[model samples]
Structures are given as C-alpha cells and as structure tokens.
Target: MLFDLPDDAVLYTALLARDAAWEGRAYVGVTSTGVFCRMTCPARKPKRENCRFHETVAGCLEAGFRPCRRCHPLACGSGAEPSVAPLVAALEADPARRWSEDDVVARGFDPSTVRRAFKRQFGITFLEMARLRRLRESAGVLAKGGKVIEAQLDAGYDSPAAFRAAFAKLLGQAPAKFAEDALLRADWIDTPLGAMVAVSDRSALHLLEFSDRPALPSSLRHLLKASKGSLGLGRYAPTDQVEAELGAFFAGQNATFRTPLALEGSEFTRTVWQALVAIPAGETRAYADIAREIGRPSAVRAVARANGANRIALVVPCHRVIGSDGALTGYGGGLWRKRNLIELERGYARA
Candidate 1:
C-alpha cells in the first residue's frame, strides 16, 4: 500500500521538531534556497511558507530542488552508512578507475565489509556500483561513435575480451555488435532513483527498465532476438522523447507519457498492460481487481504475471498495483523503488 504522509501542518510540525521518524519517508524542499533536506537536517529551519514537503527524493528533484550538501539527502537508505560513505566519496572522485578488491584492501577496508555495507543500504555492492558507472560512461562513448577499443581503455579495462564480457553481461550484446544503422537503439536515462536503459525504434519506445534490474540482460537479449540483431547502442527519436517525458515525470511537472510505445506481448498480456495503464498515477489496484477489470475474474494469477512482465516501468504504471491486503507486491524494479514511486505519485494525485 502507498504510505500516506501527514498533512502539511503536521509535516511542518515534524520538520520543526527535527523528527527522525520521518528521516527516509519525508523530505523538505526550501523554496528560498532551492534545496531539499531530510527532516532531521541540522540546518536552520525555513519559514513555514517557504517549505515544500515531498515524499521522495524524486519529488524534491522534480520540483527543481537540489539536495542539501550538509544533510546529504541523496545518500542511500535512511542515511549514508559510515562504512560506505568514504567509499562512495572515492568513487565519485575517480569514477573511471577500475576498482578491485585489492584496492579496497590497500585502502585498509575489508572488501567483504564494504560489500555488505553497500548491499544493505543500496541493494548493490560498491564494486557493482562502480562497474555500472564505468559501463555507462563507455556506452556514452559508443553512442557518440567512438571506437570499441577507445571505450574499453576509457572504462579502465585492459583486456578487450574482459570489456566485451562485462558489456555483454549488462547489455546482452557485445560492444562490437552494436551497428551504426540498427533499427532499434538503446540509451541510458538517469533518474533520481537510478539509471534506466531505454530501447526504441525511430517512432516508438520498446523497453524502459532500470539498468540494475536482475532481468535486464535477459530482456535485452529477447529484444535483440526480436529485432533480428538490429539493436544498437544509441538513442532514437522516441528515446529522446521518452527521456524528456521521464524528466518531466520525475520532476512532477507532468504525469502523462506522450511517447509512443510498442507493447510486445500476447493478447491477454497486452490487455492486462492496457488495464495497468488505465490506473491513475496516485491510485492502486489488486491483481484480482485488474483481472475483473479485464473480464477475467479467474485470471488473477495471470494478471500478476502480466504485471511482472511489464518492462516499461513508470510509464506503464505497474508499480501502482498492490496486494489484495494493500501490501506492496512484487515489482521488477524492487519493492523499495515501488514504494518510492507510489509515494512520489501521491503528489500527482494532490496536484
């Protein structure tokens, strides 16, 4: 179920109190400074009229507020883990460096401890985070027509085979396989929550999923096969269009997705996805409710399957589905993200 925040007056009171209970669940965007902070931020409180309360970091960012440096509101989880903070700082300092376990040991931190801390807070190990960043940089180079070897060296990879393997593991296609004139092109879109990979043809978006999703490689493989190996690393018109739409969406400026979508699935699955699209941004539906909506009351299980199969994330609104008891059900983007998405959309409801 979506977590409903207290009314503005109550939130204002909490903000004044420096409430820790609302640490991860609520944020305050100051209109005067255009900065957002956690409720527990030690900075002096803003005037009541200057404060804008948001349920998620995405909401704050959508409203044109930058994270407060003092509070570090963008840190993972409730706050940055002490063990993970320095490592994140180092990664930011040198994102192109190929980090290894030996480097972690040389820095006097146990690799396992660092791994566990990052996983506990971010759902990804610090090394995985660094690797993803490097790969994203390399992908950008390729998108701009750089050579594969240049990209490999720039990403801090010494071996061509190693670079290809890592690239394929994340994108399901070797760097060399991306054709310049492919019909379906893929690109990365950065959002407040995380980075997303978008695949599109000239006129329609085909898939949009968080890059860190466990199923991303398989989804890309399927897309490659379906497109007859015409998938490449670059943006198409629809990719640019969807990227802008996503920016507007996360900024809370607009909830509507104007980009054309190519829904690839069976008739029933397409029907279920259409039903999901019908659900308003701030509302949720149960699997059985969706089944009944599609005139297949006994197909609740199938409806759940279709929800899981949705690849387009926020634009399809699959995260709005909840359990029959109003519990947050399984979401491909992870339950934490589902909760944030639901919370962020409540702003849309109110607007």
Candidate 2:
C-alpha cells in the first residue's frame, strides 16, 4: 500500500490538510528534522521535499526518524508518557496510536530529555518501542486465530487494504492467507540487536531469528508448511524461557541456553546444528571444523547449508561459526550482529 500511495505533492497536500482519512495510512518522515508524523499531525508543515511518507512507524524508525512531538505520532490512545510503565501499558492496549512528544510534555515531562533517557535505557526511542508493541499485538491476535480484519483493526489500520499491505510488508504474507492452527507460537523478543522473533510451543523452541532477517519470511513459510499451518503468533513456554535466558546471555550473566529446541532439519543438517550448539559460548568454529565434527569432512558446503538452516539463533549459536580464513561469514541475523555477539562472548570469556 505504501507503493500505492499518492505522489509526493499529493501526499504533502494531505499532510498539510491534516486529513483524517489518511490517519493510520500514511506517516511522513521529515528529512530536515529527522522526525516522522502522521498525516493528521497538527505540527507546522515541513517543505514538500523534506517529507518522506512511510506506511508504518517501523519504517520511519528504521529510516532514523523520531516521532513528532506535537501530533503525538507514537501515542497509543491512552496518551501515556514515556517515562512510566503506563506508557508500555498504553502501547499494549492500543499500539497503533500516533504518539507525539507533546503527549510527554502534557504529562509534565521534557520531550528531549525523555528521548535521550529512553534511548540510553532501551537502546531505541519510545516510538520504535511502541511500533514493536503494535506489531506484537497484531501477531498475537493473528496467532489466536483472529480474522485478518480483527488483526488489522487491532493493529490500528483503518483501511483493510492498508492493513494488509503493512502486514505483508512486515511478515511477507497476506493476512487473510496467513497460516493458522499453529503447533508453534510466534512471539517477539527485544534485545540490543533489535527485535528477534521466536516461534515455539509448550515443549521446545522451534524457530528464532532476528525480525529483520531476509530469510525470515521463507523460514516461516517452510515451518508453516512443514507443521501443516500450525504456526501462529503468541508465546509458548519455550518462548518465555528463551526470553529470560537471552536477557541473561546478553547481560553477560550467562551464555548458556538450556531451552529445549525442536529442530526440524535433515539428518546432516541436524548434525551440523548440534555441532554449532557444541561450540562454546565464548568460542568460534569454522565450517570445515563443523563438517569434520559431523564426520562429513568433505561436505563443507552442506555443513554451511545446515548451519544456515538453523532456526534457533542465539540458542543454536550459529554466530559462533566463522570462515576458515578467520573472517566472519554469513549469519542470518546480519554480520554486524554476529560480530557483536562474538565480541560480547569473547569479552565474557576473558572476564
């Protein structure tokens, strides 16, 4: 739906008019000010060329745009301030509100100071956090077998078409066609590395990957097909367990993940995955080393494929693998995250 949006001049016109029809449909990220706002925002309009319209707050945040203060572009309907737990609760209750910095100021808080504090504490601005909350709410609704309409409405999209487009943009699938009756539940976990999506059931963790991983859509498709459409969005026991363990792991309290994992892979791939798990938290391994460990010394490519196929990210430790040349190779989560993980682990190892 983002691509279907009107031309820049038309969109800028809508923003200038503060069109309520465009509410929940278009967000404008101003290049000059590095701020994004809903079309309905009451703030002074920026120049036409300064505006970059996005379909979702996530896009704005990813593009480095802070939420507008006057219009409260990130505010849930509750108008909660970012300084308290009420803000999170408000987001959970209605994640789609365009919260603005003025909402914070209305609650006797300083917008710039709150932004700085939130970034320091959460490693992301309040708008990004609210965006994630909205996404999680939609995912949870869908996971519970709610209709596409329900999920769309809950996600704050007034237009079905716009909602479908946003859903597709985020999850790479049309909402109506998304799988249901999932044997595994999908939930989001936040970390300094951004947001990670984890799918699991009561017993074992099935899949975990950074939300931005390119392979995420295909992986979800494969899992849904393999499990016969039994992958919905919600939390399972394994999800809770992994979230806690991951927090500790990232905090350097412990690197061990004892969460049970239900790996779905070929025998060889499973072997490779097991080898990856065997890699110590503060250590690195090479593809050839993994192949050798799996008794497939000549299957370097296959081993690499197996490693790439791993569904559980941190728990499986795929980031621990490096190229034989000592270069950080491909990681589904991104090489930057891999590098950080390695650095974090190595530091912990020394400590």
Candidate 3:
C-alpha cells in the first residue's frame, strides 16, 4: 500500500525490500482466490494483475476479500494497529455468545493481555465491551418496553443473576431496577478520544465523565450516592441533547447547549463551574478568572480545585481553564489531550 504518512516509512521500506513490516499493515488481495493474505503471507505472490494492496484489513474486506486461512489475517494484535481487528471480528462473529474468560483463553490469548489491548483501543475490556454491547441491545429492546425475560434471553444471559451482575457492573444498577422510562439515566458512550459515562435525570443532566479521566469512578459513585440512586440510563433526552451539541462543538459548528445540569457541589463550586462554562467554546480562562467570576477573587486555588472536580467534561468546560501565566495545567484527561483540545478549540475560534 502507498501509505503517505511518514510513520509508514518502515512499512514502505519493508514492502520494497520484502521485509517484515508489511506483514500486517499492508495486505495482498489475490484476485483468483478472492482472499486477502497478510504481507507475510507465505503463499507466492500472484501475477501483478492478480494482486491489490490495501492499507487496512477492513479495507480489504470492503474490497470483497475474505481472510486467507494460512495467514490467519484476522489474528489479533500482531499488526501495527495493535490488533483490534481480531476482537472486533470475534464480536461480529459471535455477538450473541456469552463471551467469557474461557472464550478468551480458547482464542489462544492471555485474557489480561487481550483485555489491556482491547481496553487501549476500545476503552473497555473485551468481555466488558461485549457486555456493554449486549446491554445496549437488551436495553434498546427494553426501551421499547420489551419483557424483562425477552431482554434477558436476547442478551444471552442464561440466568437472571448473571444478567443483573453484568448490567450492574456496566450500568451501576440491577436490570430489574432500570426505569423503563425514567426522566434520567446513565449510560456509556464511546468517542474517538475515550469512553465516557454520562448520567441524566429526566429534565437535567448530572454527570458526563470519561472513563480514563482518573477521578471518574469516584465522581460517579459520589454523585450516585448523593442523588440516592436516581441515576438510571444515559439514553435520556438530556444525554441526546448533550451528545449532539458536543458533536457540533467538536466539529467547529456553533451550537448552544440548553440542557439542565445537576451540579453536585456547594454554592462556590457551582459558581466556579458556571464560570468555566462561560469561558465560551473556543476561548479559555485562568483559575483566577473563574474565581473572580464567582466573586471570590482570593479563592483561585479553590476554583482550580473545583475545576478539577468537574464531572461533566466539555459541557462544564473544565478543560477550558488553564494554568495562570498562560500555561496548561492539571487536567484529568491528561495534559497532552488537554493541550490538543485547547488547540482544536483555538483553531475553531480563529476560523
């Protein structure tokens, strides 16, 4: 494949010299066999007319090439992309199966290693990701007011306890306790950056934190406990509103979010969050600015602390607050992503 990125230098070199780098990133699709093999495919290269190169295995599949058996083109993680192809393929292959540790083991993989790899790519372990997929499907069926038994059967749960356990572990509540049409609910949403856990109650949103944001688990737990377990699914109106607005915001489109937010903080902290949101889509502010906005000029440190405690990400706009003296500071999403986000926003503003 003619990958133009400089990072593909090694792959090109490998391809030119018949070296090893081409083993994964580039695949050879054989016309006669209608199967694609990895660069390291042991089969002799077909005539020039019979071979086509693709940058990704998915691309090859789209080009109508089924995987070749000898090369095991779908084998997970031996590629440059870190092998999400296998896990995804496995899921697509057996979406209805109750994937387990034994399933992981039977695939000739160390569950932890596979877990970490999938988590790195999909932001959840294979089992957990599968569980979430199952939950979403089941939840959708139940959202239409399907019977609990039908939802349980559709999710591949042989027993009520197992289904409840998976649902609780992922959704933080038992399936039976799920409100069929609650005003608010919490759910997991995947984005290009990472996995986010969003919570909403019927007229307002309460939480939206990334899973890898370090303080997410505690922040969510605290909110859940304080709200006395009113949080249900993240599929409510507020979540849809926030998700769409966020998509627009990320796309550099001008869209205002008007959803009600359930801020879980004292008066000062709420004021700080309000200032944070007021920083605007593409602009930023210092902790001192937030403090001043809250009419507590001397509480800059407290403002920073409150900013750090923010559970809602882009909505609360905590990432828009930078260090004093124009430096980027502590962000739960990691400083690098924070910088990138600010840069992205700055570009949006300038354009």
Across residues 1-351, which tens digit of lDDT does each residue of candidate 2 receive? 234565567878898898888886778887667667889887888987466676665556554455676776655232333474455445545557646677667767777877776565434576657655556557667766788888777777668887787676666567776545557667666554556788887899888888878888888777777777666667889898998898677556788899999988778788788888888878898999988888878999998888888878999999998999999998888886788788778756797
All models: lDDT? 0.82, 0.73, 0.67
Ranking by TM-score: 1, 3, 2
Best of the two (1, 2) by TM-score: 1
What is the lDDT, from 0 to 100, of the residue 197 in candidate 2?
A: 80
Query: Model 3, residue 313: what's the lDDT?
Result: 86
Per-candidate clashes, comma-separated: 1, 15, 11
Estimate the TM-score of every prediction: 0.75, 0.62, 0.62
TM-score of 3: 0.62
C-alpha RMSD of each candidate structure in angstroms: 6.9, 15.6, 10.0
- CA error at residue 238 for candidate 1, angstroms: 1.1
* Span of 10 residues, lowest total lDDT, candidate 1: 57-66
Worst 10 residues of 3 by lDDT: 1-10
| Candidate with more favorable, higher lDDT: 1 or 2 | 1
